[model samples]
Target: MMRILLLAVLLLTVACGTVTPPIDIAPDAWISYDHKTSYFVSDAGADSVRLTVKYASFTFLDKSAELLPVAKSVFQRISNELAEKRGTVRAVYDSSKFYESVAYNGVSGVSTALVSNELTFSAKADSSGTPTSAIEPVEIVQKLEALKKALDSGLITKEEYERKKKEILERY
Candidate 1:
């Protein structure tokens, strides 16, 4: 009977381990994001920004060896509005998003979230004095449009949209 019980426990562990993380667990870029990915931003003061990234509980990393280029895209967009912004991006893990999140991948049924870590990137201002932006940057207007789309699709609550809208506008 003891042997049977041990076998049962082993099976359970294997089943639980079957749950895969949404992002590639690469040594180089363990965390990644894409155009579909969205995150909340707030001013943490000291020229530091706080980003609430969503992540799957099944696959979470307290620290990744390197920051993915895709994640850096978020910083580039933010720097467009706050040209003077400086400091490293710090990631903090929290269950808040897991509690508050109603989002999931329809195809895989995996939750989306940021690994939540701080990374450092320096933004260099253009000397041309022209409005042209580096291709890495996304315009505020575009972000607003995306937020509206999420609302229209019922992906987020009206209150969430309003709060994010305010946060984005406040920085610029």
Candidate 2:
């Protein structure tokens, strides 16, 4: 009886203490391979994050409405953190899992991706909104073109690429 009680307490403690770490990243570059994304974050930030929600056969699903919340959460965290540090979050890269409502065992959701312009504004732009130290409109066009290529190659879904492309253009 005593052993059972001790084990129960230990299990409860572990479950309660399982805090998911915040996604801390300010990447110079990255590749969002559908779900398993690899970042080029500096030494100060992790260079990768992975989700096991999908695997071999389940990989490369389309982004559904259910997954939008996960994506939004990721963007919000990074944007807020960067803002607090007096910097701009030019982009946020992440893949999220959305669980289904009817879980017989433990399950649920969809997929989406965002390829961001990792360029931040220079401290000195000299009146022009363009970042003096960053790429201009031409670069944005290049990024859009590259995104299209990714879509063509099936690296990213149509919705994911289109959404990312729109975000970049709107911000420019």
Candidate 3:
């Protein structure tokens, strides 16, 4: 009986040792963000003056093992968006979209939540100008419409369409 128990213990140990390790085991890592704010505005200052708006700071965490795939998928989507426009583009994370997350502790085998956060981004700009506040939302809608049209027309590929569509829909 003792020998059988020892054999069982050894088998269990071998099974445990053969399990795949989690990709990210560290507590801290470098992060990057696509946007600073989800919302942007342009205010009119003078006649025909363009107001350039900027968003706030965003943080990216490199420690999320599960979220890594989600993050990369989002990034690839954004890159596709930029590739379509042939113009400068930026993406930001929707803080409102952030959901609670949980992770299994490697050492304890217990589930733990490593706080989740939001990130946002804006296209790089050099000049600062004011935009008519009244038309800002209208302009955004028109832009979205244009993007949709581009997708339908095949000017932007399907993958690009899906990504940009998701990005825009997240705004609403």
Pick the TM-score winner: 2
Error (Å) of candidate 1 at residue 167 is 39
lDDT against the true structure, each candidate: 0.44, 0.41, 0.39
Better of 1 and 3 by lDDT: 1
Looking at model 2, which ten-residue stretch has the lowest summed lDDT?
100-109
lDDT of 2 by residue, 42-140 (tens): 322342222212111112332333443443455445544443354432323332232221111112222333322232322333354444445445568
TM-score each candidate. Answer: 0.26, 0.29, 0.20
Most accurate candidate by lDDT: 1
Off by over 4 Å in 2: 20-74, 77-126, 133-172
Candidate 3: lDDT over CA atoms? 0.39
Candidate 1 lDDT at 170 equals: 68
Global fold similarity of model 1 (TM-score): 0.26
Candidate 1 — which residues are off by over 4 angstroms? 1-35, 53-68, 82-172
Write down the RMSD of all candidates, one decimal each. Answer: 14.9, 14.3, 15.8
**Predicted structure 1: lDDT:** 0.44
- Tens-digit per-residue lDDT, 148-169, candidate 1: 9999999999999999989777
**Which tens-of-lDDT digit does each residue in 54-155 have in candidate 3?**
122212322234543454454345433532342333333433443333333333333222222232223433334221122233346777899989988889
